[model samples]
Target: MTDKATAAGELTDIGNKRYFGEGLLRWYRKERRDLPWRRSRNPYHIWVSEIMLQQTRVDTVIPYFNRFVGRFPTLRHLAEAPEDDVLKHWEGLGYYSRARNLQAAAREVVEHYGGEVPRGKAEVSGLKGVGPYTTGAILSIAYDQPEPAVDGNVMRVLSRYFCLEDDIARPATRVAMESLAQSLIPEGQAADFNQALMELGAMVCTPKSPSCPVCPVGEHCEGRLQGRERELPVKTKAKKARPVFRLAALIEGTGAYAGKVLVRQRPETGLLAQMWELPHIEAPDEEIWNRLDEGAGLLEAALAEDGVRVKASNEVVGEAQHIFTHLVWKIKVLGAAALEERYVADRTGYRWIGPEEFENYAWPNVFRKLLTEYFLLVRRG
Candidate 1:
């Protein structure tokens, strides 16, 4: 906790924003990191950086940010672009929902906000996916508004400086932390003030093995002075490991001369929704194929035909792992023989594209890599 004398003194100077503001500004001028997002005061760039940084590391976001900014240099560019193209750019950098929400928010900005990002908290927060932290981030960092932009880094810094006992797991912690941040925020250039605290947390007062000796506000850090640097920023609980689900299917009856495979479009919801993949069913054990049609079975039943024969039974083409927030899929592609012109129609269309045309379609690179590796090793084995 802040010493009584120091708290009382700082509180007395609260009304005089000039003093606190200049102090923070001076420190920030000497200590801020050279991040790409910090190079410019563009609201759209700040918004993109904040979104990409969610559940993502800063080092990992550098290249993604560069590529993203290169692709969509402005809010108008992103608003007019297609969602899939944006999502494709965001692939490999997981947490795909961010990309979708970003596109939605961009369109709203162009349509509603007159093509400019909102500078106020209420307006920024009302966007589709920008939350309190993001709103503050954009407002302060981009517009130099007096918002604290409190994120995990800010929370840790505040928690340790105040030696806060509140568990950060609770939503109320956010409310309290933001309040405290606002209370201490140096006025005028809210940008530098917010960046100072964030830089302090990220670069010096890290989660573990903090460099308290070199911290800018070392004298003011209550936790550091009390020999509790590592214990100040209390965390909540740990997450349980995600459970894995497996799915597979046998492709059969299709002639090798025509060179086509039986694939299906997944439902328009849930994991990898709308993505095309080979027909498969999720089964735990004990011959999952026994319950499905092979040649004159499920495929024929679904296709309403009997002119089919099983070529490959259950040839595992190897496994590809896909992960979501709460789910994991160990996907196995079972190769099989298939007859010509035997495929389901309507909402799901099965096409036989030429081998060279594989690049023409957009498939999750994970599955594409899996298929490539599987085919390559099959010939060797």
Candidate 2:
């Protein structure tokens, strides 16, 4: 019923699958990292961990995840929280959109899924931002389904084992890996097997300088046999370098009180949305200083950059440098006198809040710290 080539291919697939399970599992059971996420099977906890772990390191995610779970223990709690409150809890986590998305997805779950994290892969994947990998992880580890959640660790392990040189981001690689994973998804023990493979790759079959000699399946690793472990998981293109930006903001120094700073809320979209930040300009120019001299600095240019419209009516106080994960913003702080106008017309998306209000305004930690440092310097001066 089968030709020799077909039979050989099947046998090879079996060998690879069996070798992966035994090797990775044996190693994982022994050397799995003592991560907080591993301590629970509750779908909500698993869901939170999966979301936080995206594009973030395990070490970096620990405190944030702990704080997030402590603050919002369940889906219902997160679903009902205000966006700013959620952003407050998510401070310093960078990638604020993930927090926003998590809350959005939570609301969807409460409304449509009976306040429970969906167990079906299709249902889970269909949520706001859950992708195939997250869907697989939720269904496999949280729901104990035989779904495979492939991440960077899994990609590296598989690519090295199969000696695949294709870029893991490519769909062809995903398809091939999914096919292999389907064949290997253990008949009845999906959770342990999936976790075991992930743990092993994370702790042993790591991307760089993996522990090969102690690897339980080192003998079966194609890359190991070929001495090409570090060379697998080849990326198609290098990440392009982002440009640096100078930040300039005005603080109301000549106002009625004369020492307080000026800050406004960013729009409720794009980067740093709904967060309180100082009135700033990109190319701090002659027009900025001219407006500052008249106690009515201009904010029109910056607002235009963000596709909003507002007038400039403030003065300069100071400046600061802020480094983002990908972009650097050098902020110029200017203490300014306020204009006697309080309407949404100032900006379709802005609010003028005083010092006390700044604490609860959800400014990025970088800006918050900058304001603090600037104040301290002025006090000392």
Candidate 3:
């Protein structure tokens, strides 16, 4: 078979391709969800929504998208905004790196592309956080270019329709999927077609149980016909997240600093970079970490290593967990009070802030909820 024939494969017959595209387009136009992002073809708007939608559900991203655009109405606004302000807005969204990279790419656009989202594939793809999928999404959705936005949803839909058994987790499979997706895009309908594929995957051809009976293109679905619809889009399992134990200090204020807690900003790099949280230290093991008394002593000694002294109480303030792709932080928050009065003001990345000033800093969701709850109790007393 020729290279074109091989790439096209047996499923690329003209009649089948035409039927699939037309059916998807018709179904999408009539049944598409009224998402906020679908209201415009503006590249910036589409770009932000696409980024926000990554690994996030549509219902969850709706308010965040609306608020984000409302706050940073233009690319110039996002480019010029402070990193803290951007992170503050993206506080609960998780994957904070997305917000940071979006701002960085926005700055690059303002400096190079005259503050407008560029039309060229290379230019769009060159921006920070703009991967192959995002590049295709921006180009096809905004510029109406016939690029394939083949994310998981698109991959799943294609795999089921064509009965592809290749592991969707593999990079080579994604390239093949992208090629197939691009080929299927009808002329001048790139945006709608791409969205339609995603819609079908998300709403009908779901991972657990596909709604094959009501699927728009169910008539010709190879996976369903062969009774392999549940397994066609083969994917390897990801590594389990490793668990970590740590103790955090919820130090109450004293003397000059009253009705406040001690908080610190994380280092400029690494996991949860540059975000604020209560002072904490990694425990040697879960046994020591679970023992409130030993944990308090360990927490005090750990803080002393950095020339800051805190006398920890035996009381446990709260417990929370923050899960990342690779690890899970099992944090036990303990009540404590500052022993070093001199460092209570503003020493290094540490500071004492009251409940009213919580908005001034961006905190991880786990810490935010812990501190917010603590303050509410303080207020009630």
User: How do the predictions measure up, each by TM-score?
Assistant: 0.79, 0.82, 0.95
Kindly report the root-mean-square deviation of model 1 from the true structure over all alpha carbons.
4.9
Could you give me the TM-score of model 1 versus the true structure? 0.79
lDDT of 2 by residue, 1-381 (tens): 569989999888887778778766666777777888789888888888888888778898899889888989999999998888899987777778888988999999999999999877777988998888888888888878888888878888888888989888888888778776756777777777778777767778887779998888888889989988988878786454454434345444343434455567777798888887766656444343444543232445544565443344343355556555666665555443344434322555555444555577687876788777666665686
Poorest lDDT segment (10 consecutive residues) of candidate 1: 291-300
In the range 146-238, model 1's lDDT, one tens digit per residue, is 787888888998888777888887889989999988777765767888888787778888998889877756666678878898987788666
TM-score winner between candidates 2 and 3: 3
lDDT of 2 at 293: 41
TM-score of 3: 0.95
Q: Which ten residues in a row have the lowest lDDT in candidate 2?
A: 336-345
TM-score of 2: 0.82
In the order shown, what is each candidate's alpha-carbon RMSD?
A: 4.9, 4.7, 2.5
Can you tell me which runs of candidate 2 are displaced by over 4 Å? 5-9, 250-259, 284-358, 378-381
Across 160-255, the per-residue lDDT of candidate 3 in tens digits comes to 999999999999999999999999999999999999999999999999999999999999999999999998789999999999998999988878
Name model 3 segments beyond 4 Å from true.
Answer: 1-12
